[model samples]
Structure formats: structure tokens, C-alpha cells
Target: MRETNLDNGVLILSEKIPGVRSAAIGIWIRQGAAHETNADTGASHLLEHMVFKGTRTRSALEIADSLETLGGSLDAYTSREHTSYQARVLDEHIPVALDVLSDLVLSPSLRDSDLSLEREVVLEEIAQVEDTPDDLVFEIHSERLWNGHPYGRSILGTKLSVEGMKGERLRELHSESYVGENLVIAAAGNVEHEEFVDCVASYMDTVVPGVRSEQVAEPSNALAGLELVDRKTAQTHIVFGAEAPPHSSEDRYALILISSVLGGGMSSRLFQKVREDLGLCYSVFTFQSFYRSAGMVGVYIATRPATATRASEAVRGELERIAEQGLSDVDLDRIKQQVKGQVMLSLESTGARLHRLASFALHDEPFQGLDDVLSGIDAVTCEDTLRVAAQYYDPGRHLELRLGPS
Candidate 1:
């Protein structure tokens, strides 16, 4: 991998993998929901949609056809800490991919007509979230977990917020957050470092350097207990979570191992104990959401409304067990291998590498070789896992959300 910084403050990173016929390119901006005010909630996500609507030189259809005709793909997504626009194409179409991506980032029209249509599209998206019980529960959990912070709000924003969004407001946001200093352009697979750098440099030369927005304030650690929202669904969706280490913590590797052993797969403790043995409702798992300054670890289970209490008890039992006794050496070794294998397998894809590069750049995390990552996972000791579990897995600190028939 190679990295270059343009005078305009745009950072470009590239990795070349031989024998691959395709390349993945991504433009990442270090701004998302965390950067917005209460009045301008969801502007980042709304801007993501508006960018693809049109550009100064290409209409929406033209933007779509430009890549589709080449058997390529273009996509974008918004997250709490950042937003990404990515493309995958045959090596020969690298230039075309770069051109389209650059245009979307640099010259989006953000027209009133497009805004009017996209607003409804975003509104429908907000409704879709409300309609999905499982999704709505997590959003509710987040609101209570982060409580009063921008991070607590739904990424889709509220209906009223979207309705109030105007073309001029979104354009103002675009100008402020989408500047040169906050941008990272990354590409991997079947590309030369210098050539990719030059390709990006040409299009980004006009971007004026600007300061990045302030970082999000750290969230309070006060626990909000069991929040129940009534829905007429047959099954109940529950989430239990607490504060965990951020993306940059030294204990991150240990936390990953703990999360895997607790609920990562079919063989995980949650799946084996809750689903396989007790015959709870089918889906049960664990997840971790890591941001620059804060993170969350949680368990999710869906079961018949009658069994909600039992399922919750079973999850709590496992959490207490791990916090008290920790994992056995054999279990620790096994989960480390699982994590190492997953990381190695994912790096085989150019898209994954593209994202990894951009993310590492944004967080100022040093790029570790695959072997180094595997080594980090392997080096996590039973004692290390136990320490993390004791610190982060206290049931008293957890916030619970349940959505079901009341």
C-alpha cells in the first residue's frame, strides 16, 4: 500500500494486487450524523442521496448509465462517524470510475427538483425503519443509550426533520463538510500507486482546503434500564447493551474475542444456549459498534412474546458467567482462530481492502499487515479477555430495550 497527500489536502491511498481483474475505489468523508445540529439532522444521509441525483456535467440517468454500461457498480452509505461512496469495475474502467466518483463529490447539482423527489424517498426510508420492529428496537436502544447526544438520533432522522430540509440547507452542509482536508480517496486491486494518485489528483485539484468539523462529545455512561415500547408484533425484539472501548483502544482485540465467543456464530454461547438448547425464537446474536471516541457492545434476541422474560434471563446468565469466570483457555484459542480466519478471508476482496484503507486513514490508525492483525488476535491472553469482560460486561451498566405486543 502507498499513500500520497495532495497540496489541496486530499489524501490518496492505493494498493496493487496482482492477478486480479477488477479494482475497487472509494471516496470517504470524515463527517456524518455526529457533525450535524439538531435542526439539520440527517443532512449527511440526505446529501448522500442528493449527490447521485445529478451533477454539473451528468444527469442522474447519465451517472447511472455511465457505469452500468461498463458492467460496473456504484453505491454509497452513511454511518454515524463517516460516509462513503464506492465503485467496483474492471481494471480497464478505472479512469471512468474515478471520473464519476470525483464528479459526484465535487460538483453535485443538489437541484430543487431532485431535492423534492429525494425528500419523499428519504421520508419513506424513515417510515420503513419505524415499520420494522427489529430495526426500530435498536434505534430506540441507541437513543436511550447515548441520550441527548447527536449520536443517539436515528441516521434516517425524523419525518419532520426531513420535511424541513431545503436545497439551500443541504448545499450549505455539503460545502462545509465535503472539503479537501476531510476527504480520503482509496483504491485497491490491479492498479499502480502513482497512476491512481495522478488520476485522483487531477479531479481533486480544485478542492479548497477547509477545517474539519469538531469531534462529537463523549457520551455519558449512566445506564438507562429496560425501555419497553409497545408494538402489536407476535414476537418481541430485545437489545441489551453497555458502553465498550472505542476503535482506537488497546483492548479492542480482546473485546473482539469476547464478542465472538459470546455471540458471533452458531457455535457461540448465545446461539448454543438460547436457540439450540432452549428453543428460543430463531435469531440470536451479539454485535459491537465502535466509533472514534465511544463504542457499544450488545446482545440481540427475538422470541415469542411469552418467552421474552426467559430469553432475557438466559442472555443475562451468560453475561454474568463470562464476567465472573471468563473464558477457558481452549475457548479463547478457538475464538482467536475464528477471528483471524474472518479477517484474512475478508481481505481477499478489493472492496474490503478499499474500505480498510480509507477507514484506517480516517482514524489515523497505522496500517498493520494481515500477519500483524492475526498476531494481535493470537496474542490476546485468557487474562486479557477476562479483564475486558469484567470491565465492560457488567449487567448494571447495560441498557435494555424491548419491542413487542404489550
Candidate 2:
């Protein structure tokens, strides 16, 4: 892996891999939904859509066709801390991918007509989330978990906020956050670092090195109470969790091991106890959402409304036991192997490597080699898992959100 800084303040990271025929390139911006104000909640996501609508030189169809002709793919997504636009193509087409991606990121048209149409599209997306109970329940849980903070708000924004968005509003937000200093260009697989750097520098050199936005501090508010939304659905979707550490926390590896032990796989305690042994539900799992300053670790379950209470109790019991007794050396060793395998498998993909490069660059984190990561996972002892669980997995700190029939 190599890192370079363009004169314009754009950070470029690349990984050169031999014996591969394809490459993945991406432009990662440090701004995302967390950067929005209450009045413009979904602006980051809306801008992600508007960028592809048109640019100065290419219409939406042209942008789509340009990549399709090369037999490559183009896509983008918005997350809490950042937004990414990436492309995957054969090694020989790396230059084409870089050109198109830079154009979309640096020169979007954001036309009024395009914004109008895309607004409806985004509104429908918001509607789709409303109609999906499982998705909606998680969003509600996040809102309750991070109340009074930007992280609490939905990425899609509310109907009123999306409706009130205008072309100028998006332009203003873009101008403030999408500057050279906040951008990182990353590529991996079947490419030379210097050549890829030159290709990106040609287009990104003109980007003005404007002031980047400030980072969001961790939320200080206490977790709010349980939130129940009546949806009249056949199954109740519940997300129960408590606050955890940030992405950069030393305890992150430990939390990952604990999450997996709790609900990561069929052999996990939640699945084994709730579904296999008790026949409680069809789906039960644990997850973690990590941010720059803070994070959340939780369990998600969808069960028959009649069995929701029992399922919740079962989940609670498992968590309490872990907090008190911690995991056995056997369970710890098993989860470590599971995590190590998952990490090794993910590193085999160029796209995943591209993402990792960009993420490390954006977060200013040093890259950890595969062996190092595996060793870190291996070093986590049973006592460490128990310590994190006891510190961050307290039931009193947990917030629960439920959506189902009245």
C-alpha cells in the first residue's frame, strides 16, 4: 500500500496486487449524514443521488453508459461518517474509472429538474423504509439511542426535510464539505501506484482546498427509555442494545469477539438459545455500529408477536450471564478463529481492499497487516472479553425499540 498527497490536498491511497486482472477505485468523502443540520437531514444522501443525475460533461444516461461500455460498474452509498463513490473494472480500464469518478465527485450539475425528480425518488425511498418494519425498528432504536445528537437522526431524513431541500441547499452543503482536504482517492488490484496517482491528480488538481467541516463530538446524553411503535405487523421487530466504544477504541477487537459470541453465527449463543433450543424466532443476531467518537452494540430479533416477550427475556438472560460470568476460554478461542477467518476472507477482494485503504486514510489510522490483525484477534483473552462486556454491556444502559401490531 502507498499513500500520496496531491498539491490540492486530496489524499490518494493505492494498493498494487500482482496476478490479478481487475482493479477497484473509489473517492471517499469524510462528510456524511452526521454532518447535516436538523433542517437538512438527508442532504448528504440526496447529494449522492444528484451527482449521478448529471455532471458538466455527461448526462445521467451518458454517465451510466460510459462505464457499461467498459464492462465496469459504478455505485455510491452514504453512511453516518462518510460517503463513497466507487467503480470496479478490468486493470486496463483504471484510467477510465478514475476520470468518471472524479467528474461525478467534483463537477456535478445538480440541476433543478434533476433535483426535482431525484427528490421524489428519495421520498419513495423514505416511504419504503416506513413500510419495512425491520428497517424502521432499527432506525427508531438509533434515534432513541443517540437522542439530541446528529447520529440519532435517520440517514434518509424526514419527509419534511427532504421535501424542503432545494438545488441551492445541496450545492451549499457540497461546497462546505466536499472540498479537497476532506477527500481520499483509493484504488487496489492490478494497478501501479504512481500511474494511478497521476491519473487522479490530472482531474483533482483543480479542486479548491477549502476548509473542512468540524468533527462531531461524542454524545453526552443518557440513553432514552424504550420506544414502541405500533405498526400492526405479523412479527415484532426489536433492537435492544447499549452504547459501546468508538471505531478507534482498543477494545474494538474485544467487542467484535463478544458480538460474534452473542449472535454472529448459528452457533452463537443468541441463535443457539433463542432459535435452536427454544424455537423462539426465525432471525436473531447481534451487531455493532462504530463511529469516530462513539458506537453502539446491540441485538436484533424478529419473532411472532405472541412470543416477543419470551424472546426478549431470553436475550436479556444471555447478555446478563455474559456480563457476570464472561465467556469461557473455549468460546473465546472459537470466536477468535471465526473473526480471523472472516477478516482473511474479506481481504481477498479488491473492492474490500479499496474500501480499507480509503477508510484508513480518512480515519488517519495506520494500516494493520493481515498477520497483525489476526494476531490482535488471537491476543484477546477471555478476561478482556469479560471486561468489555461488563463495562459497556450493562442492561440498564440498553435501549429497546419495538415495532409490531397493537
Candidate 3:
């Protein structure tokens, strides 16, 4: 792990797992949908789409062809708190990855034609999410849980925002939100540290604004017990959520443990009880969305319309039991081992390592090494899991979202 500061912005580049044939390069920008107001909602995600249309020296096809010709792939995504653009290529094509990333991110044209076309694409995407029950469930959950805050707003914004967004406004947001100060360039696998640093610095140095962002606030909200949507669907999509630790919190590991125990795999409680034993549903699992200022623990289950209520109650019962009785030593040990193994296994891949380094640099300090991560995971004990379980995994705080024939 290596840390460098370029004009007040931090860049963390980690080169682990030597001699790999492939490399992963990523840029993590701190600003996301959460940073937008009512007027500029979805600007972050829209700008993400616009970057692919054209850049300073590369057209959309040029960017695509650059990576495709090298036998590599380029992908990007925007979330509630961050946007990431990444490229995976052969180790020999590392320079090409950097070149394309710099051009798209630093020099996007955000042209009128591109903006107009991309806006339609994004609007269609928003409609797609609305039409899909699985995706729509999470949006409903967010709206019900974070009801009054900017965090509750959709990442794709509204019809009005998408329709009204222009080239100039999108470009302004690109400058304000995707600056060097709020960005981190990270690459892992078969790359030299000095060479990677030089490449990133050369591109980032051309742009000068330093890391300056508004103060982030802690998210606090009362959980709702019931939220239902009557839709013409064959299956019921259920989402349950509650407060959790932010990325920087000490309890973050505990949150991870809770999620793992609940639905990390076939051996997890939700899977074993809901799927293996009662055969209540075909799919049931839990996840943790731990962010910078706040977080949430969510459980999602999709089942036939007939068994939706049963699955919902079973999920609630599992939460209540865990909260009331705490995890057994045997169960806790199993989860700990699984979590540790998962962590170690992920380090083997360059793409996972690159994303991990970038994510940590944005939410916490850039210098948090894998060794530190191992130490933290190792330090977790059954008592630590119990404490976290008691703190944030309360059943009464659980919010439920159901989408189907109600």
C-alpha cells in the first residue's frame, strides 16, 4: 500500500499479488447523489454517463475502442455516496488504462448533443428501475427510511430534474463534484508503485482545485414497521432496513458480522431457516450499506405472492431472536472464519483490491493498509458481535418495504 498527496488530494495505490496478467484501475469520487439538492438531483450520476460520450481527446467510440482493442473492459457506476470509473486490462496495457481514465474523467466534453442523448438514456434507466420490482423495492425502502433528507432522494433524480438538466449545468456539477480533491486514483495487480504514482500524478496535476467539500452529517431516522406498494406482480419483493454504523465507525466490522450471520451464505440463519427448513422462499438474504456519515442494515427477500407474509414474519422473528438472545459462540466462530476467509480471498483479485483501496481512501484515510484490515477483523470476538447486535440490530427499529399485490 502506498499513499501520495497531489495538490492536497490523496491518492492510494496498492500493488499486491505480483505477476498477475490483469490490472484494475479506479477513480473514486467522494460526491454522489447524497450531495445533490432538489434542483441538481442526479447530477452526479448524469455526469457519470456524460463522461463516456466524449472527452478532451477521445470520442465515445474512441474511449470504447481504446480498451476493447487492448482486450480490456471499462465500466462505471454512481451510488448514493460515490461514483467509480474502472478499467480492467492486461498488465501490459496499464498505460492505456491510465490514458483513457484521465481523458474521460479530466476532460469530458459534456457536449449538448451528448447531454441531451444521455439524459434520455438516464430517464429510460429511471423508468426501468421503476418498472422492475426488485429495484423498485429498494427505492421504496430508502424513501420510507430516510423520508425527509437528501439521502432519501433517488440516485437517478426525478423526471423534472432529468428533463431539465442541460449541458452547462451538468458540466458545472462535473467540475464541482468530480475534482481532484474529492477523487482517488487506485490500481492493483502487476503494477509498480512508482510507475503508477507517476501516471496518476501526471494526469491529476493538470487540474488544480484541491479537496474541498461541505461538512457531512450523520443520518438519523426513525424506522418504519410497514410500507407496502400494490403492484401487478407475480412475486412479492420485501426489503427490511434499519440504522447501522458508518464506514469510519468502529462498529463497522460488527455490522459486517451481523450481515454475514444473517444472510452471508447457505449456512446463514436466514437461508437455513427460510430456504432450507421451511422452504418459505427461493431467495432471502441480508446486506449492509455502510457509508461515510451513516449506514443501514438491510434484509431482502423475494418470494411467491402467497408466501410473502410468512417470509416477512420469519425474517422479523430471526432479527428479534438474534437481538434478544445474541449469537452463540459456535455461530459466531463460524461467521468470523467465513468473514476472514472472504476478506483474504478477495485480496487475490486485482479488481477487488483496486476497488477496496479506492473505497477505503474515500470513506476514511487513504493509508489504511490490508495489514490493518486483517488486524481489525482478527480483533473481533463473540463479545464484540454481541455488543454490536445489541446496539443497532433492534427489531423495533426495522423498516419493511413490500412490493406486490399486497
Candidate 4:
């Protein structure tokens, strides 16, 4: 693993198992929907699509052709906290991967024609999410939890905000927010350290300084209560959320342990009780989404509307039980193993590895190694899990959201 600071942000380069023939490269930026005002709510996501439209020297088709010519693949995504543009290619095509990524990020043309088409595409994407209860529930969950914060806004962007997004808007956002100081390039797999650094460093050296917009203050914790949204469907979508620690918070590990006990896997309390024992729903999971400044823990489940209330009650019962009584040594050991296994298995892929490095670095932290991660998971005693449960998982703090038939 190699680490460096270019501009203000850190870059982590790891060349592992160099004999493996595939590689993944990603440019991760810290700007996202959370940084936007209401008018610019979807700028980050819109900017992601615009980058693919064309660059100053390369047409959209040429950009696609170059990568496809090398038998490689490319994709991008914008989330609440970050945006990533990435490509996966064979070892011999690392140059092509880095070149295309640089062109897209640094010199995107943001043509007028492309802007109009992508805006419509994003609106269609938003409509599709509106039609899917599972997807819609997350937006609703954030809305109720954050309660008028930018973090609650949909990353796909509101239809009105998206319609107003012209080519100039895209250029403005790209120029202001996609700064080198907030950017990091991460690569893994089948790479020689010196050659890989030279390939990426060459392009990054030419990157001009860009400006970042001011961040809004953290959301007011006044909405620290329950909320619900009612919808009509066959299966009710449920989400329970509460204030939790930010990324920099020391309690993050405990929260991870808490999430593990609740819905981390098939052996988890919710999975065993709700899905395996009672046959309530086909899907259930828990998720944590955090900013450097604030965070939330969310529990999600899908169940028939007829039994939605029962599922809600049972899930709540487990939360209260765990808070009050904690976990058995057997349960704690199993959860630790599951978390450790997930971390190890996911790092096995070049794409996943690059993503992990980029994300950790963006938060201004070193890549916590696999051993460090496993050790943290191992050190999570039953007391730690219950402590998080009592502090963050109090049932009264939950914001309930249900989308289905009444």
C-alpha cells in the first residue's frame, strides 16, 4: 500500500496480488447532494451523468469506444456523501482506464444537447424510484429523519430542480465542486506500484485548482422523534431511524456491532425471528449512513400490509430486548465472524478494494487495514453492542415509515 497527499486530500495506491490480470481505478470526490441547496439539489448526480456525455477532445462515443476497445467497463454513481467515477480493465489497459477517467473529470464538454437528454433521463430515473416502494422508502426515511436538511433530498434530484439544470449549471457545479483538494484516485490489483503511480500522477499534476461550496450547518436535532409516511401496496415497506454517530465519532464501531446484531445476516435476531421463524417478509436489513458531521442508523423490512403492524412490533421488541438484555456470547461471536467475513470477502475484488480505499481516504483517514478491521470487530464485546443499542436504538426515537395498503 502506498499513500500520498496531492493538493490537500490524500491518495492511496495499493498494488496487491500483481500476478492477477485485472485492475480497477476510481476517482472519488467528497461533494454530493448533502452539499447542495434546494435549487441545486441534484447537481452532483447531474454532473456525474454530464461527465459521460463528452470531454473537450473526446466525443461520448469515442470515450465509450476507447474503453470497450480495450475490453473494459466503466460506470459512475452519486450518493448522499460522495460521487465516484470508475473503470475496470485488464492489466495491459491501465493506461486507457486512467486516461478516460482523467478526460471525463477534467475536460468534460457538458454540451447543451447532452444536458437536455440527461436531465430527462434523470427525471425518468426519479420516476422509476417513485414506483418502487423499497427505493421510495429510503427517501422517505431520510426526509423524516433529517427533516428539512439537505441530506434528506433525493440524490436523483427533484424533477423541478433537474429540469432547471442546464449545461451552464453543470459546468458551474463541475468547476466549483469537483476540486482536486477533495479528490483521490485509488487503484488495486495486478499493478506495479511505481508504474501505477506514474500513470495517475501525470494526469493529476495538470489538474487546476477548483473551488468547493460552503457546507450547510448540521441538521437541527429538534426532529428527534417519530415520523411516518403512508402508502398503498401489497407489502408494507418499513424503516426505523434515529440520531447516531458521525464518521469521526468513536462510537461508529459500536454502532456497527449494533447493526450486526439486529439485521446483519441470516443468523441475526431480526432475520431469524422475522424471516426464518415467522415467515413475515422476504427481505430485511439494517443500514448506517453517516456524514463527517452527523449520522443515522436505519432498520428496514418489507412485510404484507395485513401483518405490517405485527412485524413492526416484533422488530421493535427485539430492539428493546437487545438494549435491555444484550446478546449471548454465541450470538456476539457469530456476528463478529459475519462482519469480519464480509470485510475480507469484499476486499478480494479489485473494484471493491479501490472503492474502500477511496471512501476511507475521502473522510480524511488512513485505510484501516483488514487486520485492524477484524480486530475492531473482535473487540466488540456484548457490553459494547448493548451500549450502542441503548444509546441509539431506543424505540421511542424511531421514525416509522410504511408504504403499502392500510
Off by over 4 Å in 4: 7-12, 212-216, 222-226
**lDDT agreement of model 2 with the native:** 0.88
- Give the runs in model 3 whose Cα sits over 4 Å from its true position: 8-12
RMSD per prediction, one decimal? 1.0, 1.1, 1.7, 1.9
Which one is best on lDDT?
A: 1
1-406, model 4: which lDDT tens digit per residue? 7776656343546656655799998888778888888888898999999888889889889988988888899999998877889999998899889999988988898888888888888999999999999999888778767888877888988888998877787787788777766677888888777787778778887666565445446777625544556677778998888878777676787788778878887877899999998899899888897676688896899998888889998889988887786677887787777777888998888888887777676666666888877887787777877777788887787777777776
Q: Tens-digit lDDT track for model 3 on 320-381? A: 88777667788767777898899989878888888787777777654566677777876777
Q: How much is 303 displaced in model 1, in angstroms?
A: 0.6
RMSD value for candidate 1: 1.0
Model 2, 300-393: lDDT tens digits are 9999989988998898898888888778998888888888899989989999888877776666789877787888888888889889999877
Q: Candidate 4, clashing residue pairs?
A: 233-405
Per-residue error (Å), model 4, residue 406: 3.3
Candidate 2 residue runs with Cα over 4 Å from true position? none
Model 1, span 156-217: residue lDDT tens: 78898999999999998889889998899999999999999889989998898898767777
Worst 10 residues of 2 by lDDT: 221-230
Q: What are the TM-scores, per candidate, against the unseen true structure?
A: 0.98, 0.98, 0.95, 0.94
Using TM-score as the measure, what is the rank order of every candidate, best first? 1, 2, 3, 4
* Per-residue error (Å), model 4, residue 310: 1.0
Rank the candidate models, highest lDDT first: 1, 2, 3, 4
lDDT of each: 0.89, 0.88, 0.83, 0.81
